[model samples]
Target: MAERITLLVGGRSTEHDASLHGYRHVLSRLLAEPDRIEVGAVCYVDRAGAFHLFERAPWPEREEVLLGGQTLGPGAALERLRAADSFVFSLLHGNEGEDGGWQGLAEVCGITGNFGPVLASALAMDKHLQAVLAAALLPGLRVPRSLLVRPGSFDAGQVLRRLGPGPLVVKPNRMGASLLTTCLPEPSPSALAAAVREVFPYDDQALVQEFIDGREFSCGVYKEHGKFVDLPVAEIVSSGFFGHAEKHTKGRAKILLSPENAATRKMRAFSQSLFEATEMATFARFDYIVEGDGIWFLEANTLPGLMSGSIFPMMLAETGRSIADLVLSAVSECGSRPARDKVLAYDISH
Candidate 1:
């Protein structure tokens, strides 16, 4: 029997649009493999957190057509998906989608797919926590000096004194896509405070880190059967940091695939180690900053973007693998794994 798969996209997160765009590509790829796979549902979650099922993959240019479907509650939607006996491939990024909420829900409901382990998703979501984990677990891995601060509770003067002079990057501690993220060349106390305050509207906490001036690169990894498979390292060439605009806007960032260099070689090795150490399942994308001999750990995306021109798909393409291959492999892997026992048995009679 063909493996049934559900493509879950969009969410209440700020990355909802990107998810919608990515799912179009995923759906197209999955549909191509008619004999081996069956696309059971193309579930779309709106920004307001309502669930809607699209009978077909909506055209990338015609996102407005999404409103045509009758809205269903989350419970109703999940129940429908559960009844189909389909494996879910979530394309949703950030917030409840990426931060273990959706993964936990699926686990509880016995629905599984490319969504990774719950703890791994949550760990990858928090920048500060990931940094701390990397520092403690991966010796010799250079993580930028960072401090977690909340609006109106952190002092800018102390931040500068600890992280060093001037140049620093301020970003929401838990958000992705560089939304509201800023870099200050010459950060004054007032300017730093203002930058941190800007993050408060979107996220409760902000991460202020000493900026590393160097080349940016990303490597992807996934488990095939029980072994780890690392993809080619790609260098991201941009004016400065690869911010939201550079990522979404076409031709803004130049991606060089399989760059032959020492930094990339080391990155591939580090990526595999990190993936295993963090218990990341399915697949993940790890970003880094290379300064001469030092490779600084930037962050990891458990749910990497697959939108048109997204980096993950580009890396996959370099290896002659498409989204279809990834989806099929993930579904098989999910099936091969032993099921988790949610409840513990006790000897009450003794």
Candidate 2:
């Protein structure tokens, strides 16, 4: 029998809609390669956690939200997922979604290429911890001076005592997307406390680092069989820094050709080290900052946004790769993995 496949899209996060857009991209490529695959369903788990199979009546173009003519609810999502022979999790941005929750569930039921288990997923999500891990593996890499703030017990005053006054960049320790990132001038002791409270809403634990003003850049890396191979480097240009809107909005962030420089070489080296250290699988993207004479590490995205024209895909095209090729490379590598066989949950026990 041909293997049954289920591609899960959407999540309860700020980027739920974006994930849906990415899913359409992945599904089209998968459907086109009919000789090598079978489709069980392409389901959408709405931002509210409501699950529904792709219905033709809802979406005019059936290929966009194409389905197997079977509707599944939230309760049935995982059940049907458990029964599939293969799976694709086309999620983008957000804590509950890409941060690892869905991948964990996929593990329990059996789905291929769902990234690592909960801990790896959990560890990779936070910017602070990612820095901590990167520091261990690539000591030569430049990272900003920063501090980690755990939930409940936070005092900006105490933080200031260690690295005092002015020019601070603070972000959530556990979340991705520049959602609640703050860049502040030197603040009075009283004002520092308020700023700390501001970041509290985003993450219980946070990382406040010394500001590194420079150009933002990212590199996408895919697995060439078993070895890690680097993709084209795309520099992000924005008036300020590349924040949430820049990443999601069309034409906000610019993906450029490689700039020949020592800094980029180091950034690539740093990226490869981080990927190996973290044991990232299949495809991933790393972010960086190029300062006057140094490049600093930024957190990476394991599941980068990939529509036909997204940055990652755009970057790949410069290297003479097509959307069809990109999808095929990723899916073929993922399918050949042992994890793919272990996780494709076509049958779930109640």
RMSD of each: 2.1, 5.6
Q: Which pairs of residues have clashing backbones in candidate 1?
A: none
Residue-by-residue lDDT tens digits, candidate 1, 50-146: 8878654433224566654757887888887677677888888999888999889888776777777899999999999998887787786899989
Where model 2 places Cα greater than 4 Å from the true spot, the runs are 1-5, 24-40, 55-75, 186-195, 250-253, 307-309, 338-350
Error of 2 at 146 (Å): 1.3
Candidate closest to the true structure, highest lDDT: 1
Candidate 2: global Cα-lDDT?
0.68
Identify the leading candidate in terms of TM-score: 1
Candidate 1 residues lying further than 4 Å off, grouped into runs, are 55-61, 347-350
Error of 1 at 116 (Å): 1.8
TM-score of 1: 0.94
lDDT measured at residue 188 in model 2 versus the true structure, 0 to 100 = 55
